[model samples]
Target chain A: MSFKKVVVFPAKLENLAAIDALIKSTAELAGLDARSIYAIRVATEEACSNIIRHAYQGIEDGTIECGCYSNMDSFTLVFRDSGHVFDLTGVPSPDLDSCLEDRKAGGLGVYFIKQLMDEVSFEHIPGTGNVLTLVKYLTPDSEKSST
Target chain B: MEYIVEKLKHCDLLSISGRIDSQSAPELSEALDKIMESGQHKIVLDMSEIEFISSAGLRILINAQKKCKQQLVAGELVLAAVPERVHEALDMAGFLPLFTIEDELTHAVGNI
Candidate 1:
């Protein structure tokens, strides 16, 4: 079996649902269960929202391209955006032990994306832009797991 | 996202339904703000219908929680009926321990 799909759309918060729906449909067709489908959708939303709000700084209207593919072992999602390159080093994971007054929700998006997917990677090109890839391994040793 | 505000005996209950993303997050903020302004310190967010929540939404929840905490003697915001997906999302974001969450609406309202 072979499966691959791609889409390009404007980078706007209004388009988030559409992006999620597109990926959710592809994930469903790939035979993911409800939990996996929801994880993909949420992770995709966090990534795209970051682009729209931070990468683009909610200022410049940009474009984002997304792609999805299903291999025998895992499901993969890709995001390509021409917005400003993200600086991962500058962001800190929120201190979960911090007092309520000290705790911040700033970096939760990246954190959630990392938690939901098995593997996540990012790259920045001088002339192009940032490319983010997220993958979720299908249940090991089996394409479907009832658990 | 869509919300319906009900006047429970002890608090202002807002049952929010739909995706609370960047676009719709402010609406929830506004609703909470208006409630706070009206001198209603206790708020119950019935999230049984919220299917998706992004970081943006979580930010609003944290801010609201902090603000309501100041009035803890008289006002607070609690969560009830959180769906499994939403629970997992919050847990993943390290937010499960941040708020007073209950399994049922009556329990949440009673706590506040």
Candidate 2:
């Protein structure tokens, strides 16, 4: 079986809770275990935060559309924003090996999205704006409920 | 997220419960800033009741840890009773080595 859910929210930090709730409920419906649900929540939150902070530059008037899709084998999240053209693929991975002195705070959001999701892609359409898709495969152990 | 600051004998204990995301991270940052400003760098962040944490929260943690350790006084931010899910998030971000993690809140405060 396949399931699809969509939600739209203003591109503001305050809407993150709503976004997180949507992701969590959708992941539970997709039969994801607690760990996998947490992974999806973190990845989706990171993606949305990137859109709000960088793409929109803290413009609360802007909007973000989130779509959740799930099948027997995988769950996916798609984010749409009509803000600046920010590409997650171009982000350099944070140097995790660096010591405390050299470590930086930024870039971890994109890094988390890339690390937690099994597949991630970002594209900018000429008129449609930025689209980020994150996919997490459902393993046998991670699928606790039936969808 | 909600945070309660307790001034311990050896360090400051910040008991945080609820989600720590981009929206709530700044508040947490401010709370930590206030603690650090008061010259209390040895902090025990009690994460037993925390529901979730994103990169935003992790950023605050790393920044706070750096500030605590880099000061001439050489203080520290210790994490205590971190839920398993948050622990995994920290591990994935390669942040496990950034601070000292304790399984018990009492241990965290006791050693700090």
Q: Could you say which candidate leads in DockQ?
A: 2
Off by over 4 Å in 1: A87-90, A141-147, B72-74
User: What docking grade applies to model 2?
Assistant: high
Chain B alone, model 1: TM-score? 0.93
lDDT of 1 at B65: 86
| Candidate that would win on TM-score | 2
DockQ of 2: 0.90
Runs of candidate 2 exceeding 4 Å displacement: A58-60, A141-147
**lDDT (tens digit, per residue) of candidate 1 on A35-118:** 888888888988898888777885566989999989877899989888888854345677766767788868887777777788
Please write out the lDDT profile of model 2 over residues B1-112, one tens digit for every residue: 9999999898999999999998999999999999999999999999999999998999999999988998898999999999998898898788998889999999889988
Residue A140 in candidate 1, Cα distance off native in Å: 3.9
Interface RMSD of each: 1.2, 0.8
lDDT of 2 at B73: 86
Model 2 residue A82 lDDT score: 98
